[model samples]
Target chain A: MNLLPGFDDILAAAARIAPYASVTPVLRSAALDTLAGAELHFKCENLQRGGAFKFRGACNAVWSLDDGQAAHGVVTHSSGNHGNALALAAATRGIAAHVVVPEGAVRAKLAAIERAGAILHRCAPTQAAREATCAEVQRATGAELVHPYADTRVMAGQGTLALELLQQAPGLDALITPVGGGGLASGVAIAAHGIDPALDLFGAEPLGADDTAQSLARGTRVTTVVPDTICDGLRALVGERNLDALRTHRVEVITVSDTETIAAMQLLWSELKQVVEVSSATVLAAILKQPQRFAGRRVGVVLTGGNVDLQALPW
Target chain B: MNLLPGFDDILAAAARIAPYASVTPVLRSAALDTLAGAELHFKCENLQRGGAFKFRGACNAVWSLDDGQAAHGVVTHSSGNHGNALALAAATRGIAAHVVVPEGAVRAKLAAIERAGAILHRCAPTQAAREATCAEVQRATGAELVHPYADTRVMAGQGTLALELLQQAPGLDALITPVGGGGLASGVAIAAHGIDPALDLFGAEPLGADDTAQSLARGTRVTTVVPDTICDGLRALVGERNLDALRTHRVEVITVSDTETIAAMQLLWSELKQVVEVSSATVLAAILKQPQRFAGRRVGVVLTGGNVDLQALPW
Candidate 1:
């Protein structure tokens, strides 16, 4: 319940992940800026190690563990970027990584986790199944369970990206990131607000997966029915801590459709030649959908990841 | 003919285009390195302004002339990257751009050129018609001509990429690029030789558009009958002057099939999350086709462009 990381945690995470993570370039899109009548600066976290910003948190978490704790290694449940990031971070430290991946996940994602020397444990195709299997693996191997988003360390680690962005582009009118499980969005909101309380923070959630948007409106973490979103990475229900952060920070929740996300993904590829996954597309989608809110503003958006299954890109 | 520009010309061109052009990052692909058993240092000109490296030469050529030239603006014949790059560069320099594009060229490319504030002069489907009309436009308006290749300034400008690459990765054993009208290939050879005469320079052309490969074998320029390559940017025959440059440099010529080029493009996109057009895949195709020549050595590959027709990606 008291798991929210403070500003100090984020600062410490920045120091820990400094050596491993890339300081991705902040790019101004002439085309997108002109289209939206806004000055948009994109923080390209998609270009970071593991092709996603998740590596920042994962690397910090894996490296900060004690020698004995690291020897036993880390375990986590993720079907996407977080799995590959933790796997790679663990391998870099010569420690073990046990990823309890759900069945029916992309083969390429699984291959990436394995290639990074992470031991894969398949489970039933459900969040409950993934978490339960992850628990079992932790019990069997005495591995430290690395919660992808809920862990204070992981959240602190993710917040470091915002710290870098604020340092690089000070006084950006607003900061926006896509919300899936709200790990990155929560972390970004906290970091950006810490730097400047007046800085507006927003979460772009896919329309099909608008759990966060609904919860933000209801002023509580609300459970969702079965999800349906072309953007695979934004399918997670909002967490309690993330909901509190969203409520506390007054993070505006805007939703964009699958069509807009696909259009945005193609634009990045066509204009910037930056191949990003649909998850990253959500930020662009939200901006395009709510142009009035963002127009004529100096806004910063994080392209959170780039681990797209090319053959299976969301149409 | 004593028509070529000396080192000073290239330096001037670099200075001219520096303001308008992107200092595109040179990326290293570890997965690709392992596959070929060689370190692949990719000079990512694909991410250059206008989604192609042509911006360098085009910008240089368009901006090199005096105030009179700016008054008349510029004209060129291209079915793809050259047209778009020239148009965008001309727009950035606050000048008019006249593009003589052949019918049957990609509609998307034509739209991009138009969007960049270029006046479109569409002609018959033949390259000859396009060139003839471009000449007419040049003669009528007295507009400065920025030849796609085979111009002293353009070749020297393109050579700048090789200069940067060599400076970035001095230990490179070889430099490889796709040849289309021999502009990029010839410039790469010249720059590579200028950096180190021992550096092996090779042109990786499409088998269907293997005019350069055949011409080198014949000791003169030999045009291919009908270009059948899916590498659309490499369909043009090598310009006479560019051929001479290649021959003078004693550059080795290699050819790969469309299948290999597409595969290489997909590999680069999926593994590295870099969205490169098919033309940029030539170097990788050659290495995959003849791994023996490249294994156990350091290779520098110039990804010439990434202005792909996204709807028509040959994935």
Candidate 2:
């Protein structure tokens, strides 16, 4: 049986990635609080080293490698934030990073990943094609496959965000994170629950891609429907290990429609004065949708990322 | 002779406004540093209470009132950030704020001021009309007049930004702030020079509205030219007291074209991942324009505010 990462692993990851990953600030907006009927603490991972929480996971995975394995470098299949994060993390370690990006990935995102010094191997815009391309490149280059959300080390790295958040604003009644492949939410659940067993953990997802919510309801991972949301970063199927972690922790999953997500995004932009992608807006949408769930409580909302194409803004 | 505010006044203002204003974070960008060939520390007043550093001055001015004046409240003529700042500051002190806003002011900005709970007095879209309305409101209400950038207390309050910046990032070789009516720049000059006499101070301005630059060259305040710039927040002519402060500190004035300012705004949005108005981008434009003067040095750039119209994004 595969064992899930414990709080000890999160502590170790926090120490391991301290030099690379940013201890992002916990910001408060009074306007946001009034709207939600809750005191909200936002962990601004959008201001993280690679402009996302993915940098924490990527950095931990890159640095955790043994010397022999390190020399071989790291490889991943990501069209956006994760690709840029892994590339940046690898550059810090002075190791090669091979990112397999699909053909229809946003050009701005592709440029950012390339700028971080990743060798891009383009494939057709499909999961099978991306995986096939990544596997072939790994074989050709002898690079170690660092699965974006499934790997234990990446989950531990993502968990460090919770560690920092709790330290920044301790005694949070609950925590909310966007669930795509379930990496961030899974890690957050582990860390927050480990610190305070009674602390409620929630996963926010787009209604169009409610696989995680559906999986939690069905007691199994579901990967049939194609995502149809503007949150491009949340199009991946939930990994088996990630599902195991979420289920074991009893994480409550909630989904918000794209219309609600867009409205929440506008409110965030107007209220918080920050530029966040549509993916990061899901948690706020969830809070606004069910105010009773979070009202009068201190809720921690993890802003997953801020790598956006300015020219193609959704608003 | 109008004596410029000293370090002690800034200290007093800091102490007075501590409860109302925010000690905003100083952020850094590695990519931006590499591009500018300088280590840049951005004092993000855009994240401050009411979303601007104007709150510092307004808060200081509001609380400095004696019992009779406090009972009567305060009044100002502003169509943007200052109006919002004063309204919020007055609310904190449990007093009325009369903001004389000109007709045809940006709808979003006017809405923000109103939401902050200011009693908005509308007037013709002209400086004389605005001043006349403000005077009438003050006379009718027995309210104290707080000129946006001209008053000694306001200048001292604005100087608190420099005090915080210096404390946050010590040993800076230079500091840059956009020059509008000269409140922020004048205040920054006094605070920075007071801390380290050797530190360089620069005032950034748009080529279209280069009144401060012209005033510095002519050794007097210039107020005749029709201001024309995309920076709506920076069209005001330099105040006499602000000019005295700037002249006393020997501030170097630099001007960048509106085109260059827009490019810098884009770069800031892409690199910094924050929604800042065009007025706030001039400092970065100045840094990028004069590379040799600032290359390889530590520089502090004050992001003055982040109030922007989402529906009318310049890009």
Candidate 3:
């Protein structure tokens, strides 16, 4: 099996998950456009199934398995949108989903996972503990492991967003998405570039979790930085295969401070009138930070998710 | 003057404002559907140009004026979405807008009006004082008076939303909207019933400000209810012409307490992933309160606005 999804994979995934995921609306705000001095077409994945673009990848992965492999179910480790996404995706196929959630995960996220009928297994917050818990769950249930971002199927599924976006708002000069494990950015880079070779690819990274930026600069993967930003959805280390796609596409990574992200989050909420997550704000923040880079250009911004704890808003 | 808009006016308004206002998308939530046991179609006027349905009426009213009248501009006494809508509408015509705002209005709303290029005129927080200020402004500058809801032209403008909703999600068994001055409700009543006379129409009102409900029962308009709800947008007494439409169409007004409205507001924010104002929740609250009336039916709900101050969320 190919380790990285090609343009063909994205096309197939679009048809595969067409029955499940939403073709979330592309929103535009004259106010936001004026503020950034760029024509922005916001692909509102925050309104996607499970309230995030993770649903696209998770649904594709869960449904891609053969009957024999699918009967055994699926298992993964995620403490955020991915876990909630997998749980909902598995339900579509009448299969069990085992989520290995880290200890001290957000209470709201955990509750949402359980609500989707997934059996949750708690483990220490450390990466080693999370992997071990996932391994044990898989061993016991004979469920296939579906990594949130590293797998080719997941990346292809996420790439479907670019296809829909390009069709919805044609002639985009560039596209930007917040990079967590590089799943969305990598998938989008491949798909967008495949469609328009000269289109620019950009990733927004939190300054506190600038591992993607660091790895790109060093020309190799780096995972030593400890994340300390309020953008909970973007702290994961970049997946190796995911990084390869980003590197191949020459994706430019832009780092934004927490303060900037929060301020942009407020602007998005007020101007777009959409409840986007804090992580989603990074893309807008990046564009505003370097207006000269984006001025007078048509930009496609993927609002990655909207699963925020309202009571705990930073502002 | 007709004093009440008919189907023809709604069609005319639709054509007039087509160039200015957005045809806000209709959103659905399976979770909410299961919870309510009804297929709900949310007409998201919250995503409208001025972040509210008020823009439809404001835009129509502003553009409907003849060149002679348009040159002098327009004036309105409003402390909420209407002021913002009128300001924005007037800007489209390159004419001045004079807004008479009451004392102690929400600071965010005032700022939005000013940002839209309307000159603000402050008045004592009383109906008589508000009218006096508006009259004074109109006399000084031949600016035409555009009442928020009572006027026929304004009602026709608000009715345009019903035209869009019916086309977007046809075969609706019923429609519901929050009744403030009954602008949206009255206008929607005429438009919906004109399209399908058998369609049911309902008005959601705050228990603390249930003047419309009380008026309907007494066979006369009521104007003595001192508003006392968290739904700041629904505090106005129902307009005479607006009440006439409601009464003529036999609209059933359902009053909900602050507690029920707040709970429904939270559900909307979570399930719909939209930042609807507290007032917008009233329609959902009314539907959820009387499930028997709405069960197994397709209900078109008008989300009035999304102008709530995030810092002062009721929940």
Candidate 4:
């Protein structure tokens, strides 16, 4: 079993990825605040190096390797933000990155990954198929596998965002992030809870992909639910170590419907004037749905990414 | 004739509007910088209140009034960002705002104005009809008229952006802003030159509405040439005082076709991960077209707005 990343790991990761990743600005929307009835300090990871907070993790994972390990390069199985992020991260260190993309994955996302200098390996659209292909690539090139969210290094790297957010907007009463494979949420939980033991941690998940929520309720990881939402970024099953972090941190999961998420996405675009992905909208949607839980509270909302298909906007 | 605002006015306006207007962030895109062969700093006024830099001018104009004048409220003839901005600004002071909007104006824009608490008065789409309706509304309500981009206070307010930009990204070799009615360009020129007299000033104008370019070439203001472009925010004729300021500052006008602007907009959306309006993209398009002028130089590009119609995107 992989050891879950602790706050110390997150601290080390912050320093390690400092040079490779961007300290994205914390944005605010008075209009959004008024609507949510909470002070929303948006940590704009959407403007991160690879257009997502995934860069922090990918960069940290890529750079954390020893000189010998780094020479072998990095390999990841992702057809989304992680693929592009790992590719960009690898380029920063002058190393090869092999992205195992499943068939019928988003063309735009694939193009973005390729643009970031990743060697693409096509595979059948299945969890097993993707892992097999990634394994094959890793073996072929003797590259170290960088699991998107499940790996300890990636989770520790993602936790760096919480450190920056706390410093940028101190005295946050609570924090929220979109929960996909639980990489960001689990990492943020470790960092935030370590600094402020009393700070409330919340995870926003799509109703269609409520695996995290169901898992927490049952006190066991559930990987059976198939996601059916516009938030393509949040379809992954919550990783075991990530779920362990959520349980340890006492994170409360809130699930929002696709309609609510889309509406919140529109509100974000119109009010905050930021092009956040549908997946990122879950945080705001959850807040809006559970006003009583967050009213008048100072909340740090993490906008995970802004890689969207403009022509195929959900609204 | 209205007196043109100077650097001193910009300084005063910066202090005056500091409480109301946001000091928008200066964003950087390494990818875009490489593409332009220049160091680009994007002053994100699109993230400003009312989703545009128009709020800076509108806020200043509304707040510059004496108590008695303020009690009477403010009025402006605009169906765009200025109208919504003025309404929001007036609301901040607990004063009424009357917006004279043209018939057949964008329904969404008008709705935004109304949502900001401005009473909308519709008239024919002609400029004369808009001015007449505004004048009539001012007379009836005893409200002070706030010209969108012509008035001294408005220009000074817009100039605040330059002050913030210079402070945020010091040592910019050149500055560029879209020239609509010349409010932003003229104000930026005044403020930037006041700080660094040797700094180059450039204006990005749509080829379809090349009135500013034509006027600059003819050595006189040209009010003709009906606009025909996707850049709806940049169709107005340049104000006389604004033109004088532009000429006084020796501002160079760069006109780009709609195609180039739209393509640049895509690049901004993809690379910068920001939702900027088509008009704002003209600056990047201009820099890309005239690479020799900006190559290896630090250029401050102002993204003027982010109020594009989601369903009716140009792309």
Q: Give candidate 2 regions above 4 Å deviation.
A: A1-3, B1-3
Question: Model 1, A93: alpha-carbon shift in Å?
Answer: 1.0
Model 1 residue B186 distance off true place after TM-score fit, in angstroms: 2.1
Write model 2 residue lDDT over A22-96, tens digit each, in one string.
Answer: 889988899999999999999999899988999998999999998898898899999788899999999999999
Q: In model 2, which residue pairs have backbone atoms overlapping below 3 Å?
A: none
Q: Can you write out model 3's per-residue Cα lDDT over B60-168, one digit (the tens) per residue?
A: 9999999999999999999789999999999999999999999998888899899999999999998899999999999999999998888888899999999999999
Label model 2 with its docking quality class: medium
Model 4: residue B63 alpha-carbon error in angstroms: 2.4
Best by DockQ: 2
- Candidate 3 ranges with C-alpha deviation above 4 Å: none
Give per-residue lDDT, candidate 2, residue B235.
90
By summed lDDT, the worst window of 10 consecutive residues in model 2 chain A runs over A1-10
Candidate 4 per-residue lDDT over residues B1-315, each given as its tens digit: 167888998999999898888889999988899899999999999899888999999998888899999999999999999999999999999999999988898898898899999999989998799888988998899999999898999999999999999999999999999999998889889999999999999999999999999999999989888999889899989988899999999999999999999999988887788888999999999999999999999999999998887777787
Higher-ranked by DockQ: 1 or 2: 2
For residues A1-315, write the lDDT of model 4, one tens digit per residue. 167888899999999998888899999998899999999999999899988999999998999899899999999999999999999999999999999999999888898899899999999999899989988887799999999898889999999999999999999999999999999999999999989999999999999999999999999989789888778899989999899999999999999999999999988887787888999999999999999999999999999999887778786
* Interface C-alpha RMSD, model 4: 1.3
Point to the candidate with the largest lDDT. Answer: 3
True contacts kept of each: 0.76, 0.61, 0.55, 0.53
| TM-scores of all candidate predictions against the true structure | 0.95, 0.98, 0.98, 0.97
